[model samples]
Target: MNNKSITAFTLLTATLLFSLIAHADIINTNTTGRNTFSHRLSNLYIPEAVGGETWFDDQNQYNKLDIVASGTAAYADITVAGTVVGTTAEGANIYATDNSGIGIAYELNYSTPGATSPQYAYVYPNKLTFNGSGYSLNGYMHLKYALVRLTQFVPAGPITQLPTVTVNYHNLGASGYPDLSVVTLQGISAQPQITACNINAPGSITLPPVNGNSLVEGAQGITDAPQITLTNCPGAINNIIYDFAATYYNTHSYVNGIFTTKQGDGYAKNVYIQLQDATGTGIHINSPLTLPGYTGSGNYAIPNFRIAYFIDSGTLNTVTAGKVETAIDFTVIYN
Candidate 1:
């Protein structure tokens, strides 16, 4: 009876050891019991356009952290939790932060022998597989981040804390595997100041009267030079762009900066208003013009811009003497 009891005890011990081993296929050996990834954007220049486009930092690839899981071959489903601000064209997720008009995108790369190169995917929700034999459940897993321009970011001042995103790795319904591992994705810190500029434009511009007989076909009659000033512009802005639009009417004549005057009994006939530079060069309406070397806080006057009246080449002999008036609007763009 004693010999039989010894054999049974040995068999029971072996079964328990096997069970323990089977349940310990995956292990979390993170010394700190947590994971974090951070990125810094110093003096980041945001794009001025607001058309649902994304911009990544130059050092996005290097902005990463290592996450390690030790033990045996398994798979983990990765997910994230945060305020989703927007999405990329390729369907990647963009998370919001404390700063307005800025967002962050997360990416993950799995390093396995089966992969000829690093397999990368946006960390919205993805699965990572550990299929290599003798590979460390302890080996490092790399996670990267990038700064995406969700919209035109015009910060009020220096940027401080953005926010954090919670990333989770779970092995649900998988027998003997760890349930979950959490990683916190930190927001980018930056010091970029974007200032708002005001356009000081003339409400109306009036030209001097001209003799009707002196106005020949295609000849300019009267002219006025108006200055459009930009005020409260900050030095942080590299340059400024501006364009003009006709507010009164839409006609093919706008291509030559010509507009029809207000219709009335005394309104000018066979004569139209034109806009031109001081050098008499015709100004293309709705075309963007960049202000060169515009960097500072001061008043900037639009150079060489003027308006004039010209005889309608279409009606050469029927020029009438009357009022010639029109309105124009201008828009300023900067970053």
Candidate 2:
């Protein structure tokens, strides 16, 4: 979890999602000569799991009178906008804590109303989590939050230190004032580090088969008994997205989901390549493949994955003994 807070928001505007009658007085929290507020939501460093909670306190006590005589103080839809790359809003499992405590009483519901609409389903004055399907995030992620009461709100305890709403009376010869304040929420933005990996020796992969003819004739092809190691990648990278390409072997390029070698000008015919994970499982070059278990902090070495040249005896019928060589381009990436 290489999570870092890239920036902070100086101001936020309140927006009304549902129509509500106006009667309650509005007071600025910034009246105290302070326009900025800070919230430490560092817990969102890594996206919260589907059933996790990202706790946060607005640091503001709710004390606004009902605009409709029965309305309560509540926060509404979390409006999300701004630029995101590598993953879509749907791909990123973003969710807010709808209830209190450990959030275990109710089942987890992972849903979003497309990208345009702000995601809702949480009570106000609580914490929110990016509760979306797990995906390593890249580029920038920003979310805007707003508050609105949906129903009558009752404080668990006494309300104190609220601003004053004054009214004067001449006929009745009495004056009364109510404590009041506005609910202003802050926005959050983060930029987690991208996935990176360094290969040991990527220039040339030489496969020394037992013999050109016997190599293709044998039932099993060559294996990376001594795996080529990869190192220095972020711990968040659980898997690698990779593909292989070879112009000469373009006709017989993809074999068993692995990239293959080309028909050389020399002896090897119908020759191809096969890639396996550290566990010896064939890696599908078309999609992302899980990397070896990371140790949190250290260079990651892939001990199981290896590549070897194989000849399709059935197609070529004859395996040439002279020169069995073909160039291959191996590309590795983590999503």
Best by TM-score: 1
Question: Whole-model lDDT for model 1 versus the true structure?
Answer: 0.56
Candidate 1 local Cα displacement, residue 205, angstroms? 1.5
How accurate locally, in lDDT, is each candidate? Answer: 0.56, 0.34
Clash total of candidate 1: 5
Superposed Cα deviation of residue 251, candidate 2 (Å): 6.9
Query: Which residue pairs show collisions in model 1?
Result: 69-137, 70-137, 70-138, 71-137, 98-162
List the candidate 2 regions with Cα displacement exceeding 4 Å: 1-190, 209-226, 235-248, 251-258, 276-282, 295-297, 327-335
Candidate 1, residue 207: how far the Cα is off, in Å:
0.8
> For this target, which candidate reaches the highest lDDT against the unseen true structure?
1
Please give, for residues 106-167, the per-residue lDDT of candidate 2 as tens digits.
01111233211134323321122322222212211122222111112211211111111111
Could you estimate the TM-score for every candidate? 0.45, 0.38
Q: Could you tell me the TM-score of candidate 2?
A: 0.38
Worst 10 residues of 2 by lDDT: 100-109
